[model samples]
Target: MSKPIRKAVFPVAGLGTRFLPATKAVPKEMLTVVDRPVIQYIVDEASAAGIEHFIFVTGRNKAVIEDHFDIAYELEATLKSRNKTAELELLSRYQPPAGQTSFTRQQLPLGLGHAVWCARDIVGNEPFAVLLPDMIMKAETGCLAQMMQVYAETGGNVIAVEECDPALAHQYGIVGVGESKGADAFAITSMVEKPPKGTAPSNRFISGRYILQPEIFDHLSRHEKGAGGEIQLTDAMIRLMADQPFWGTRFNGETYDCGSKIGFLAANVAFGLDRPELNADFRKEIARLLG
Candidate 1:
């Protein structure tokens, strides 16, 4: 049997220039989708998917992200004094067990591939999952968990994929479909980073969740820059793919790219409406705002 996937790497070093003023001092990952910071949702998903070790590849001004996972003693005390049992319990539930979390700084804006490479020492010689916090997946089964199911069946690289409009496929990393592995999973014949409009191999675009073998570090160590003149993770994956089999699964859910303004606002509404206490009122508020 393949080694159990017990660790997950989160690449959170991106400078959120797109979000601007709001992200000036706050790490974009700390921005909230609802009541929880964006990174919390990603970590919750990883934990639900059986990831025991939480590794964060962070950057400057990102200490808040780390602290969010740590205990807030003064606040906890305040909540306790106020007898806010539910609020205090919520905080405790979110804190990962001691030593289960580790943070390493990326230091430079090298790109996603380099960020993953920064965690090589921690990942060692085992397969691991990489989750981009910006891509929040809403599903009955966490996207990474869904991909883990595929990994268990096919012991190689696995990526979560979603179909995009063919005309817009050129704007994302597109994949080619091969033979079926079973269910929504399939062999990935090709991966192209933003191919020209009509030349995309398929409409399926990688949705920022990956299960990769440690060998990928060797390929990324070369620091070869590809699209956008940065160390693109897709470039390293393509090199790794030459030797290892790759599989893709279309997760049963919606993905919100919180890095974009529109995607962020949409996620808030989507997640807010998902809460039992807020659903009815939130839906009505949305209708009112629309009018």
Candidate 2:
């Protein structure tokens, strides 16, 4: 049996050029969606999926993320003195157990594969998960948790995929499948990153969640640059597929692409509407705005 996927790598090293002035001072993953920061959602998802270790691959100016995960002793003491039980409980829940989380620096604007590769020493030879903090998924079960079930059966590499409009298939890393495992699972025969407009082999695109084997490090370590002159994780995965089995599971949820402006606004609204305190008034305000 394959080693259990105990650790998850979060690639948050990118400079959020798209988010502009806001990102100039803050890491994109530190941006708030409704109430919680984007990285927190990814961490929550991974934690729910039984991920024991959280490895963050960050870059310069991203120190806030590391601090956010650490305990604030003075604040905790102040809350305790004030008898703020509820607030203290909430704060405690956000912190992972000591030793469960680790942080490393990428120190370059390379690519996803390179960012993941930075975690090589910590990951060692164990199968680990890679979750992009930008793709915040809303599901009955966390997206990574859902994929974990598929990993238990497949015991190789598994990626989360969702169908996209054929016309827009060129915008994503498309996967070609050989057979269906079930309504929500398939065996991936091949994967192509951002194919030409109408030449994509399949309309289904790879979403941000991945359960990868350790052998991928060997492929990524080559530092070979692919599309856009950077080391692409998809390229490494393609190389890994030459030897191991790869499967794709269609996750059950709405994934908001928070990497873009519109996607970020939409996610805020979607998450706002889901909040018990805000739902009713928020829905009415949205309807009024539409009207």
Candidate 3:
């Protein structure tokens, strides 16, 4: 029987070199998109997707991430005194119940698989979702939540993938076609991360969200280095396809690669447009700047 996905892993270990100077002291995941940090949106997405436990894989300079999820005692007290209930409730939503949130550290700048491996104990032997905090998707249902619905039927590994330009397929983990898992989604026959020039199996690339079965742990345990002399998650995931069914679902949303400075700024601007408090003024300012 297909089990529910109760846990999610947020791989937040990378040093945001692309966002230097600003990221030098602050964790990139903690960088605000629109009054909320990038990580907050990811967690909120997972929560909306019915995730019961949130596991974060962090690195140095990321204590702020922990602080972000915790209640600001002084701030809450002040807001309470001022009778700012709306603002207070907004802050409270960020906190998970006691023991609901957990964190582990990835000491080295290893590959994505290594970051996920750091959280294995928390995940145990169950199906879990992994989301890279760098890829921000603006969706009403949230990408992970949508993937969960697909997982309930596919009953195997599922990932969020989007179509990229044929020439740019080498920049992502492209997938091969199998069967139609959904009306539009494709069951993955194979996947290769950043294939050589003109060698990709398909134009669909792995987006940042994934719901994987526990069998992946076995593949990852014996996984060797690939693509960057680091244990790439894509490599292990590829092996997983051999033994288990793997499928990728395409969602309706624009994904900003906040791993890069340009993408980060784009997300900030896009999110601001969705905020009632900032949209009007921010758009005016942006328009004036462009002029």
Candidate 4:
């Protein structure tokens, strides 16, 4: 029987060099999508998928990220004193229960694999999910939840994948499709990180969500560097694939790569439209702006 996926690792140590001045003081993950930080959306997604323990691999200047999930006594008191029940309730809903969240620092900017490896102690000997904060998956059923469904049946490693433009496939971690495992999943024959344009196995690219076994820690511990000379998670995954099975599920959702300006702006627009209170006015404002 497969063990329940109760923990999730969030890698949020990256320096947002691309966003420049805006990201100079703010950690990229703290950048808001609509009103909530990008990390909040990812955490909400994991919580919806039944994840109980939230492990964050963060770095310097990321203390705000930690505090965001912690209790703000003064702020809560102020809200309560003012009879701001709705605002207080919203804050409470966003705060994780005490002891449910943990934070560890990644002293260096190693890479994605290394950031994940930093959480080895917290994850211990269990299967856990890894979510990239930069990718905001907008779906009725969260992306990680969809991958969890696939993991429950397949019981190895599961990756959330989505079809990208063939011309842009080389820009992502492409996977080769194999036999169908179900309506939404397929056996992954191969995985190549940023393959040359036309040489990509398929148009399907990994969509920043993962369900991995504890054994992956053993591979990542080796600290082998690939691609850009940093410990690349793709390299460790490729090595792990030699023995274990890998499955990919094309989730019913759209992904916004908030690490990029375009994707960040798009997510704000999309999420704004998703809000019941703002949908009508938001659309009219967007239409006016476009006009």
* Candidate 1 segments exceeding 4 Å error: none
**Segments in model 2 whose C-alpha atoms lie over 4 Å from true places:** none
For model 1, what is the error of residue 215's alpha carbon versus the real structure, in angstroms, after optimal superposition?
0.4
* Model 4: per-residue Cα lDDT at residue 25: 94
Q: List the residue pairs that clash in candidate 4.
A: none
Give per-model CA RMSD: 0.9, 1.0, 1.3, 0.8
How badly does each model clash, as a count of residue pairs?
A: 0, 0, 0, 0
How much does candidate 1 score in TM-score?
0.98
Model 3 alpha-carbon drift over 4 Å, by segment: none
Candidate number that wins on lDDT, 1 or 3 = 1
Question: What is candidate 4's CA lDDT for residue 167?
Answer: 96
Error of 4 at 262 (Å): 0.4
What overall lDDT goes with each candidate model? 0.94, 0.94, 0.88, 0.94
Model 2's lDDT to the true fold? 0.94
List where candidate 4 sits over 4 angstroms from the true fold.
none
Hey, what RMSD does candidate 2 come out at?
Answer: 1.0
TM-score of each: 0.98, 0.98, 0.96, 0.98
Model 1, C-alpha of 187: deviation from truth (Å): 0.7
